[model samples]
Target: MAFDATRAGADATELDVLIVGAGLSGVDAAYRLQTECPDKCYAIVEARDAIGGTWDLFRYPGIRSDSDMSTLGFPFEPWDSDVSIADGDTIRQYIQNTAAKYGIDEQIRFGHRVTDANWNSEQACWFVTCQTAAGEQLFRCRFLHVCSGYYNYEAGYTPAFANRDAFGGEIIHPQHWPENLDVAGKRVVVIGSGATAITLIPSLVKDGAQVTMLQRSPTYVVNLPRRDAIAGKLRQVLPKRVAGSVTRWKNILLSMYFYQYARRKPDSTREKILHFARQQLGDAVDADVHFSPSYKPWDQRMCIAPNGDLFRALRKGRASIVTDHIEGFEAEGVRTRSGELLEADIIVTATGLNLQLFGGAELRLDGQPVDTGKRLIYKGMMLDGVPNMAFAFGYTNASWTLKCDLTAQYVCRLLQRMDKRGEAVCIPERHEGVEADDMVDLDSGYIQRAKGFLPQQGTKAPWRVHQNYVMDLAVTRFTKLDDGTMRFQAAPSRSASPTQTATQAA
Candidate 1:
């Protein structure tokens, strides 16, 4: 169990658990592993040089968490800020600070991109291949925890439009925003009506840019204050942790109720949301054309505007929304299908994200490849038939961390139970006759685009990923480890060390 550099090449390292990614989920997983499974050896492998996955990567005009920080933050670490909706930089700092506080930063291997992970039934371990600075490196671990988010980091989703080459203006995507590009006093057209577009419009307008959010269809937009007065008052009287817990549960219940209400009463929910948008925009913007989406509520993610910033921008004539289809790109700007030319000095494509699973790493069981799309998810964490592996995927309906925190806790409990039972391999087996469903039930553009590649869910417990956080919390946090689905076994006798084989190759 000690560092096995003697067997694998001197450069190779062996661990009890290998966590991929050093983002919020990864860091949270590390903290749980260190706390709950203190005897195990673990390391966090991050593709980027720095921590904070999505928060650190996005550096557009305005980047912030759509969900409140209380629920988004780890349950162990209480977010003490008065601002419920936190900015990107603050969130990034908080993640880094958490790592530092828990001594997790040292365990992170920066620039170690996991290219492939192969499970060896003979050794009961995962031989991970990583692309590092020198070349390909190897990491051997008993368990592989994938905390990498569900998006492609290399690029955002940008569709090819006709005559794109004719556009002479500067074009950019918020995912890869140029540091030196100037947008002051310029005409900017931000395409898409999702969260990125909502955040960017206000930020660009504040920076003196005449911004226009050009969307092909309408999306639900709701306004919330920047600071939560109730949270602030609770903090004044109650302890920080207690107040945080209260606020967290409050947000959780409210979100669950709203989502349920939206689903059960779609017409009323849509009307209420549109009414709020109309109040914010006044008579300046047409609510029916710009804010009323054709789909039912919760069909796609509802955009949250802090302090009514997006509406304020529109009211002040700093920003505007245009709902139309794009005909093509012209020399100066984009031409609409309605024959109106949108003059722009810079074009921002805030389309959507390209979804990726397990950081797009190739997975193989023994020598055979494992197709995740065909596999059933076990408790929303482990895939059926995948041994000693767990993925930290959060809720689509509620705050992401709520589910992730429970997943981390559940994994820790699993590792402990495995150790106690002297189990080397634990694989979730799919029972017969279970109905298969989409990995995520959401109809978002990104989710739909990657539906064919994602893992399938089931109709019953253990296999079903109930998007409800409360149900997930009860199941993931308190469920017995020896559930009928998860099968455990001892390690197979090996002739040679797996580490040595990998090291020699390295």
Candidate 2:
């Protein structure tokens, strides 16, 4: 395959596929593309200086995947460790190792940040604009695959606390934890009831800091073991790959069953969760006062307490949780709405993440700016009315990798189908009367706040998004590429003359 300049930008590098980001989804996409579509030429442009998108970015004291690693990790590679809840460093290494093993690392172009992707129907390719270390670089690809994780990597969401500057202590957000930040023998107050805040508390306590977690409201929390005994047992008996697949499916099924059960029977599920939560707390904190949540179970993500480490911290008097609203910041600490001052030598605002799509890159159709929020997602991968482009958005209620894995496979399937049919473009055209709804239906703060930026879903199949892995697996894997909704087009002009085609793309 050679570069095609006639149908693409004069200086643009032509590729069969262009992947944005070298994160989990990007790595997974590369694996699928190379294995399934061996003839296609592809490249991964990562904005960051290194691999492991989220894992490399967040370096908080106790950063770890909230979900079990069996599902969080790539489906092709088996997680070697017994630790279901893996630390950030280990996970980063795992992703890097996986990429290197599969030769996906060779496809990565670090420091190339894709800022814009414009579609040209005549060329049947996307002209992608990227900001690199030297300057701007352009790429033209028939298919654009966005594997960037959903979040603004530049910064995390931090609320404006009144008189925050008046505080005499060093303030930090989990997104940018400074090096040599010693919290030993100091009072530390971590604001927010989300997973980040919950994770940092136990770690801060271990660092010899007197930790106090301040939250405006209580969030549902549950404890899962750090290691999966069943996974370990399966590994010992079955072949490694077989064991990994089994462990992955076991966790996926359990997660699906639990979420559905909780949604269907919120009252009973709530009671059961609270009962187990209370047992973990065991009088270390008052359940009604500090642990009881206002929302039903599964409405928002439940805070995972790995091995009940957080509970142990509270019981041992190393850490405490305070449910209160921040009125203002004092010279020495945070002032509550009730006028109780929470004295702290250090404050960590683990508020939440700022949700972003497509790595903050702008999309255009025929030079007209496109709003994904107004469009519907197709098969939880491609966007409705968007041709030859796919973005990976993982399962909200389950492991992020589960949906991404299927999405990559779906893209490969679509590509193979397109090649076989001699189609240049494929777009899911929504029919009339397809009512719009939020793509991600979670009531979490991050999702709710970013509703205006996120895409919408329809009330029907192929357009309606399912958070369940089992449902998505069935639909994305087995569903025909040329479903009635998808409109496939071929450029007759390109087929005839001095123009761009898959063979011309390198």
Mind giving the per-residue lDDT tens digits that candidate 1 earns over 246-276?
9989989999999999999999999999998
TM-scores of the candidates are: 0.95, 0.96
Worst 10 residues of 2 by lDDT: 494-503
Task: Indicate the residue-level lDDT of 181 in model 1.
Answer: 68
- lDDT by residue (tens digit), candidate 2, 1-506: 33344645668887889999898899999999999999888999999989999999989898999899999999889887679999999999999999999999999999999898888776778989899879999998889999999999998999899999999989998899998888889999999998998899999888899999999998888889999999999988999899888998899889988999999999998888788778877877887778788888888888899998888888777888889899999999999998899999998999999999999998998778898889998878888889999998988788888889898999999888888877888899989989998888779989999998798988988888989887888898887777889998875565421123444653
> How many Å off is the CA of 101 in candidate 1?
0.6
lDDT of each: 0.88, 0.88
How does candidate 2 fare on TM-score?
0.96
Best by TM-score: 2
Candidate 2 CA-lDDT value: 0.88
Candidate 2, residue 9: Cα displacement in angstroms equals 1.9
Residue 130 accuracy (lDDT) in model 2: 96
